[model samples]
Target: MESKQTIEAVLQGKIALVTGGTKGIGKAIVKRLEQAGATVIVTARNQPNEPDATYSFIAADLSRAEEVNKVANAIHEQFGRIDILINNMGANTFPGGGFNTLTDEHWNQALQVNLLSSVRLDKALLPKMLEQKSGVIIHISSTSGQFPIWESTMAYSVAKSALNTYSKALATEVASKGVRVVTVSPGLNKTEAMTTFLEDYAQQAHITVEEMTSKLFERVGGVPIGRMAEPEETAELVYFLVSPAASYITGANLIIDGGNFPVVK
Candidate 1:
């Protein structure tokens, strides 16, 4: 294993931007990049409860086109160019109960947050990366994209699936120009938000939180690993993908689901 100092040296001069980086997997990714010696910039709708002086924070709801531009422009002005772009912002907050419960607004919101936000941000930032002829972009998607639970993940899945496709297409368009685009699909990370989600469902179902967790596993056809992933684990994968060690990789949709995605792709 490499020393932490050696790992940090891998990204000593890299500048990274992580969207929705104040919490959960996004927060973990920010920490990982910082540990790797990258100067990180974080953007989200709100500031974190405890702000760290290490990375610069910008407040913006990336679901909005204007907000996406604001973040892109601010990054450009401050950093000149970003070497690593992590599209880690996303949500599955729509009301459940399948298709009948989701309105046009829900579908639109899903698309904006999970798909178009990355698309617009890439359009704004890729110019500099192309000019330099080197950069990496990672789209943080979910395993639900290809294996959605209709009662809960209908719109969210649709948006992520589209995002996966967009990421692949973008990677193909830019591979010859020396920029790499990749999609990372994580399944059931044990983040704070996930804990709350399971708790809420447990309450509604009149079951223990553990039971609710098991129910979710069953719904997803079982996590063969028998547990949810830690956000840090996912972040490590992201780190590897953006580093030079993955130079030959592009246009790949890597799934980090602990063997939960069922069929081989």
Candidate 2:
């Protein structure tokens, strides 16, 4: 059983930085952290088009080292320090046909977007957290990191697997410094991007979207809960991990896969 008291405005006065926070899980995390009374700063390649957006937005392609430096400098000048860091900017937009179809460019792109971006940002921002002796860093990984769908996610999975290892090692190095590092591995999420991808794949396969979705479920060893996760659902777990309630949690790769992962960890 969980305690309701842990879900209050526990993040009040805290400053949080969420990379790729304009959409999907990143957007949900920004909202969740804000609702918990944290001052949130978001970064993405483009600023969102909504006129009523609230959080501070920084436009930078985190895959580039210069851009990562720019974001880090801006945050230091404006916010001084960050209480929570969510490294959630990642993608798997490469051409799919197993390892033979992937080129050096594709592999580099996947690694830059999924792994190096977070690594560089952490290098820039972690010093502040270390100085403060209290902070939380959450790396948004995927179940594919361990259970790869090679035909579709070879390079992406490889990068995420590296991220999982890095997160654990960083957590071990930083735990005594009062900075908790955690990796969150979420399974299939029903985001707009995922919906669009499914639609495209379905059209290409000459099948109904429902049929395509079911096929995906079957391919991934079936989500026992019978559905994909919502972005907000993953956000809720992130909220808890960054809160004081999770002080004892670090060096952990937590999986929220609806039982899609066949093996027990």
The true-versus-predicted C-alpha distance at residue 65 of model 2, in Å, is 0.3
For each candidate in turn, the TM-score is: 0.97, 0.96
Residue lDDT tens for model 1, 47-122: 7877445899999999899998898888888889999999999999887789999999999999999999999999
Give all candidates' CA lDDT scores: 0.93, 0.93
lDDT of 2 by residue, 1-265 (tens): 5455555678989999999899999999999999898999999998787688889999999999999999999999999999999999999887677989999999999999999999999999999999999999999999989998887789999999999999999999999998999999999999877888788789888999999999999999899999899999999999999998899999999999888999988
**How accurate locally is residue 125 in candidate 1, as Cα lDDT from 0 to 100?**
96
Residue-level lDDT for 201 in candidate 1: 80
Backbone clash numbers for all candidates listed: 0, 0
Candidate 1: regions farther than 4 A off: 1-4
Q: After superposition, how far is residue 88 of candidate 2 from its true place, in Å?
A: 0.4
Backbone clashes in candidate 1 total: 0
